[model samples]
Target: MSIDQHGDHVLQGMSIRKLPKVSLHDHLDGGVRPATIVELADQVGLEVPEDTADDLADWIAERSDSGSLVEYLKTFDLTVGVMQTREGLTRVAREFVEDLAADGVIYGEVRWAPEQHLSGGLSLEEVVEAVQDGIEEGEDAAEQAGHDIRVGQLITAMRHTDRSLEIARLAVEWRERGAVGFDIAGPEDGFLPSRHREAFDYLASEFFPVTVHAGEAAGLDSIRSALLDGRALRLGHGVRIAEDLDVVSRAGDEVLVQFGDLARWVRDREIPLELSPSSNLQTGAISAWGEELADHPFDLLYQLGFSVTVNVDNRTMSRTSLTRELALLAETFEYDLDDLEVFQLNAAAGAFLPVEEREELIELIGEGFER
Candidate 1:
């Protein structure tokens, strides 16, 4: 199981890039192409750290590979800086979906904070509309290119800010349009979901889908608040839930473990854990387990019956795609075609689409894997 220069792998005589996939935890700002960034910055006269696209890509990858979550987040300032205008927002959003489609993603939910893009004089409603327009255009373009893809917006609010309730309303207001869910992102250590109880309550009352960024920058307590306060349907990079598992013994493929009450509930309830491999290691989300990709508890949670799904989290920042992430995991874990199919199935099941749509996605994944 060796990954190629293009970040693709051949397993069971199949190219991993050709398989249908679902992306759940991708970020809009973080997935901006370096070349696009350079061009956009030039249009706005924003001074970038690197002049060329390749150099800029290297700079972002180097900066984001730092082990501190706060340091990892700083790379976004540059991206958000370039995305202040409606044209910037629309282009970035369109390219985001096109890139996902090229990567074989049949379904994806792109999350972004609308407030961060208001510096160019656009209101929250205008920004959301701009993104949605781009999404539709991207979908049409992908269709013309022989790829059928659908993308939904997970309107996000910065947890450090005080406009979560307003953002929640915005998300629900766009639910019939392109919005699919609501999320709260930003520093997670001090700003727990409990701080945004009002917004979560409103989302709950409106029956809007919610997925919180928990158990990534913080620990189990943060996950608890995300579940209890935010009523999250899925967890974004909820890799730290492994802290609750007491590995009693292990031998080859079999292991005995003690599950804490929280772990038990999450596993029993089938709450999806959006686990990103490279990003998790870079942000120290799995540092307690080890410093390598193999050290990630994703396999452990999967073996214990947790609904674990693979994610990229941030593509450009981590310099990864869903295919690359899956290839890396397959190479590390020695997984086969069947194992890869299972990960896609997990993602399809956890998508915030309607039951019939999710079932259709499952069927499509099954057919693609069977081929």
Candidate 2:
């Protein structure tokens, strides 16, 4: 039951890293390898705070652990700065997928804003194409290494800007190419999903999948807006929905709870909650619950029959992988292999893939866990 240095743990005499997993809430801009950043920054003549990749990685982890969203977000400026060109974007995308495969991810959806990467004079379409090329290459590489993996794009738009509609169109335009869904990221408190009603309306008209970053920096009102206005199929870090629940009582292995209307609707509808343990603790997303992984409402939501899935929201910034996140959760919650399998099943269902593909992923997970 001990986790090794690579964040792997043995549960039921099985290595967690060997289990097939699905990643839904991963971010492309935030998961870039520090070594790649250093190399790409060097090519672009962008000065970096740390010269070596190891030091740069430590710097990112330290800044992201500052417990403030603004301070945590500053680490992205460096990663995104190195991701402005075709080469940089392609390399980052390829390595992102490779790393996921190494961590036993059979499928993943990488989210990033195209508008942010256009600073290098590349068109929106060009950036998508570049990332797609990298994804394909990474898949091929992983296959050659005997690991089967597939990844799709979740085109995102900045919430504080006016480019949501444009980004939504870009996502739809490339739907057949690589895009699988649409999302809005960047500061969450004041920016409700309703702010981009036009984009959501268009996506609804087109019958495209959408997931909104709500309930992380905001509360029930934001979650309500995401479901009502944005028609979000899933909620990003929807951990704050716990605020609507009133813990009436608790005893050993038993607890009683009263749910508010908002909480009841979300729980009854089984909306997926992409809960990132390390990132949630660092961002204070679950501050009310407690300061450690033990305090996360993940188990509460799960025990209540909510579709709670594990995620590595930003791997590099949080210095984590899907394997690490799962291992940490298991260690904190004293979860067995069955518990780990359920998390993967929940993530597979939450993925933006077609039903047939998702069912296939579920089968893969079941078979892998059985073995």
Candidate 3:
């Protein structure tokens, strides 16, 4: 199987982009389109690194590819800068959904921090309402374009901030409107999920779904805190959870390993790990293992019955889509259509939706893969 320049892959004599998929770790700010960024920046007198969309796209890819923390962070600065108003938020959200639908993502959870978009004087409730409006518009547009897609909001709070309890309450308040879950994003190391224990405790009381950004920039302790304190229903790029595994021996495809108590618990509990392949490499989340997709412990976790779901952590920065991530994984791991379908099934099951809707997504994946 070969992936085209457009990121489309022909696997098992079928277009990988045509297969129904579910995305659980996609970031709204991290996935903005270059053209949209340029236009929005112009409206706000924001100086962008590039003038044209193509140049801006290349600029983003270059900076992200640098693998420097400074460069990677600069990308977010640009995305978050233009998304400060109701108009910007709604348009970006709509485009996000449209892009996901075009990429064959039937269902997705868009995670972003409302606190980041409040620089324009928008209230928490106002920002959530604006995003929901855009989501509805995007869904209608996708349906009219002959694609059915659904995206829910995963309202996130920055870990470095102290307003998590407030953010958690905001998420729960908007639960029926658009917010489907809560999350703590931002620098993962130094700041553990336990730091937001009050927020987690309140979310638990409200019976809200939470997914913490752990095991990405940090290690085992972060994952443990995410599970025990945050009560995370899913993990955001929990790639480093492999740190808990001791690979005893490996002979070709045959291998033996000992699992740590945390690893065993996570695996046994079937907790979903939202693993983003290219982003994992770009962020050095799997630096301990190796510097390539082949080195990712995704296949290991999958083979061991860990609910591993593929994701595109940042579409613009990594210059990736869910289809491309899956294609890269397939090329690296020699995964077939069945394996891809299983990843999608895992994401659908791990979604913050209720059981009935998740079952519909599972059925859709099975049917799509059958074709």
Alpha-carbon lDDT, every model: 0.94, 0.91, 0.91
TM-score of 3: 0.98
lDDT (Cα, tens digit) per residue for candidate 2, span 293-342: 89999888889888899999999899888888888888888899999999
Model 2 ranges off by over 4 Å: 1-5
lDDT of 1 by residue, 311-342 (tens): 98999999888889889988888888899899
lDDT comparing candidate 3 with the true structure: 0.91
The residue-level lDDT of candidate 1 at 301 comes to: 93
TM-score comparison, 2 vs 3, better candidate: 2
lDDT of 1 at 128: 99
The list of candidate 3 runs beyond 4 A from truth reads 1-5, 68-71
lDDT of 2: 0.91
List the candidate numbers ranked by TM-score, top first: 1, 2, 3
Writing each residue's lDDT as its tens digit, candidate 3 over 75-191 gives 899999999999999999999999999899999999999999888999989999999999999999999999999999999999999999999999999999889999998888899
The lDDT leader among the candidates is 1
**TM-scores of the models, in the order given:** 0.98, 0.98, 0.98
10 residues in a row with least lDDT, candidate 1: 1-10
